[model samples]
Target: MGSHWSAASRARALASATRLWRGSLSQPLLTWALVLLTVVASVAVVTTGNWVPVSVLILIELLGAFLLRLRGMVVLCSVIAAECVGMVVARSEAFNPGEMLVQGVSIVALLAFAFHREQLGLQGAPGGLMLVDLRDRLAAHGRIPRLPAPWRVDSALRAAYAEAFSGDFVVASTAERGTLLEVAVVDVSGKGQAAGVRSLLLSGSFGGLLGAMPPEEFLPAANDYLLAQDWDEGFATAIHVSVDLSTGEYWIVSAGHPPAVQLHAGSGRLDIIDSIGAPALGVVSDLRCVPVTGRLLPGDTLMLYTDGVIEVPGHDVEMGIDRLMGAAERMLSTGRGGAEAVLAAVRASEGDDRALVLVHRDQS
Candidate 1:
């Protein structure tokens, strides 16, 4: 009976979530949150014939409405619905429509304008809960393989904390010609929409440019967006680049990001790219620095990485570029993972949240 009741309750909650998720699907997670809340409220009514059951639920829904995006609210609603519906169905009698209506209406009125998230009074667990849902949504999309493939992509959060959705997102889109277009990656300083919005802005503007323009043009475009956005100092550090497989041409423009590597096709010699990267795109007015370029001849390779790859502290010095380069050369010579070898080296150096992206210039 308990299992059956749980299943029915979950089904109703999912239905509510699906309904709202489709309707306000733009913020599916938020919508699910709302649906779940409704289910919880309904179930409370059936369970205790009292307001106590849904009291906590009402608070959660209100928080979602205020703190989370519409999609997040939808999913959250679905969850609450599942719980509430279960309790309510478990006790079918003594359901009072008038009392429930009043409670619902009162909460709705308290919400003021149901659509404005910033206008909400969400804090603490409520705020965190919304972030949690958004994080899950992002994680779902961040299906990074256990190992590297010819084709790959990513958009993972640093932590699963709902409040920490926007950290560093990386995506690798394959080109129609069979070569990877460019490995697009982003690093944002903080969480919340402020951080997420910036990350999104960079990803869209830069990735869009990568589709049409060459790497030389891509950097300036990313800088343009960074300078244009309303971000304070210290909120930026990213390297966006594209590796051309056919010609062995590699282009990169960085603002406080780790440099990528180019290897000698036959000798196993690796060279750290040489170019004055612009300050983290947003810091300087208009950067005079040119985009860095190099070659990865056939049988050669390139390795791109974020700061997380090098930020591990050793003794007292942070293992920055010099150490990274040495590690790469050693790995390639040892015939380890080659272009992808430095990752393991860094991980073994210290598991300091390393995210490495290696592109080898080999004919497919």
Candidate 2:
């Protein structure tokens, strides 16, 4: 582990240095210095009566300054090299091989610098130059968003095996001016980038729907939105929860998602709340959901999970749920592990994506 970390650190350092060096070549000061050096060498060659080489070099430099392209740099260097060879072979009365050599070397060096800079720029960032913007956008829609106080929420979404983006989970939370808190978790039908793209595209629309209407209307609205897309062989399951912060009354609705487990503060018992809505969104028209209503007292915790949490190859989902309940009961009661440990216990395989959302009602 330590050696792997050391190697990764060294790689990052090298990448950063290469990026900086490439950037410095384009800076005004260094660029002007190179241009000045070329011009001075050109003047010395001109003094030696080799006006042709001088003119060609100046023209190449001027074009380079204007275009600043990779192909342009290559052409400039080739021209300079050819000019130097011509000066050496001609042996004319005005030919100065020394000055031409200097000019050729300078142009070649500049071309090499530019080439390196371009290569570094391409290879530097992990997800390319727009990664920062991409991260900001994903964090807005995919990550666990803000929730009201007295409710500590912990959630995680992991991609399928050998994938960079998770396909199963989309968590979005919004509070309506301290009165109502809304959260939605959606799982697309597939795994990997294809499903991830759908999740990304739908995140903004789904988030808007969560907060756009009353608590009961949120699921139906989402169903309508999904049906409108009319994607062939495409469907999604989701859970939407709205909580009244003042009274602690919460309503949870689902669209073909797995049941949520609620931990009672009084009895320390775990109860699985079944899905009360219609089938998965986008499957049928005129969708309606029966919202499951419950009251969350102080110290109670509710866990919302995708099917990945309780699925194994040969065993039943009920068995997986039992395993999760057992692990969560032991971990939550002892205050040792939170949502992450619960996930570790219930995780069956890497063939599918997994997501978990834990909303703990803190004791006042």
Candidate 3:
């Protein structure tokens, strides 16, 4: 038994050492190794009398700036500086003043880039990769899950100024064994990148809250969350909808958002759901949201949108709603890409973010 335990301990130690060595290959260890190689190469160039150009060493230092952490970067820069001095002292005849000036400028630019990245708490390509991952995750949260055969849902969001991030976002989930579908459309106070950070934070929080608890409790919890942030421009508007996929029964709760529009297929007329109302989130404490309930029959459609769709500068919000209804009518009548088509046809405010969601019950 003692012999067996000792053998197992040796195997474990080997495994751990292997893991550590593999991990170090990508970071500081790799950087330090490169630094040492560069130093040797620099020494060879000085001893051999201009066989390898000093410019090549400068390029290696630039590469190190991208790959190394702050400490490693500082060490690499110091090595490069020392090599520069050595080249000037040993090979003064070959070193041109113009080339030295350009190399000096390059080093300064590299240092500036390193410091800027350090300020963001991340450096190099990893920071950009992290943001891409975040954006993709945020987009994934808004994806509507597949519903029953009779239900069709689609949504679209556009940022102001064609920016990569938007102030408007959606979160949705289905619960009760896929019999209940809940969706929330949220609009942060500012437009485009100005409010994107807050939008990202709220989307994750609201997405977690959507199907975790009773649908009725989501808004209040979200409100409490936003209020806790205590930001100067923290308030936001949102509309939450819960639908019974089996029965077509739905309950909508609003937080100072634009009224939802419903298309009655039988009458071929549009009606606004205006009863559900509450103050904007984060603006009030002890808020109570009263939900308005309804049912969708075969061939019926429900549309939810942000205020940017209707808020024209000179016109009242009512006119914008009317205009939206007209554009929606034309877009839905075509029966091809309802959500994307309506967003394209509708003339929304140019300077604000816009989003739209469409849910339809197909006729049997």
All candidates: TM-score: 0.54, 0.65, 0.77
Model 3, TM vs. native = 0.77
Report the lDDT tens digits of candidate 3 across residue range 1-364: 5443343454455456545545654676767887887888788777777587777877787787767666677778777777788889888997889877877887778877888888876655455545655566667779899998899888989899788788999999999999999999999999988898899999999999999999899999999999999999999999999999999999999999999999888887889998457999999988799999999888889999999888999889999999999998887855755887898888686689999999898898
| Candidate 1 error regions (>4 Å) | 1-166, 171-180, 191-197, 233-235, 313-318, 326-344, 348-354
Choose 1 or 2, whichever is better by lDDT. Answer: 2
Worst 10 residues of 3 by lDDT: 2-11
lDDT of prediction 3 = 0.84
lDDT for 188 in candidate 2 is 84
What are the per-residue Cα lDDT tens digits for candidate 1 across 1-364?
4433343454455456556544654454545546655665665556555655555666776766654554455456556545544554676464456545654564455444443443453322344344444444443333333323332232223421334445556654445465535665556675444566455555555555665665556556666777777666435666766656555576777776766666675887777775436677677766555677777666666666666656645532234666777777777655565434565555533322335666654534
lDDT of each: 0.55, 0.71, 0.84
TM-score of 1: 0.54
**Top of the candidates by TM-score:** 3
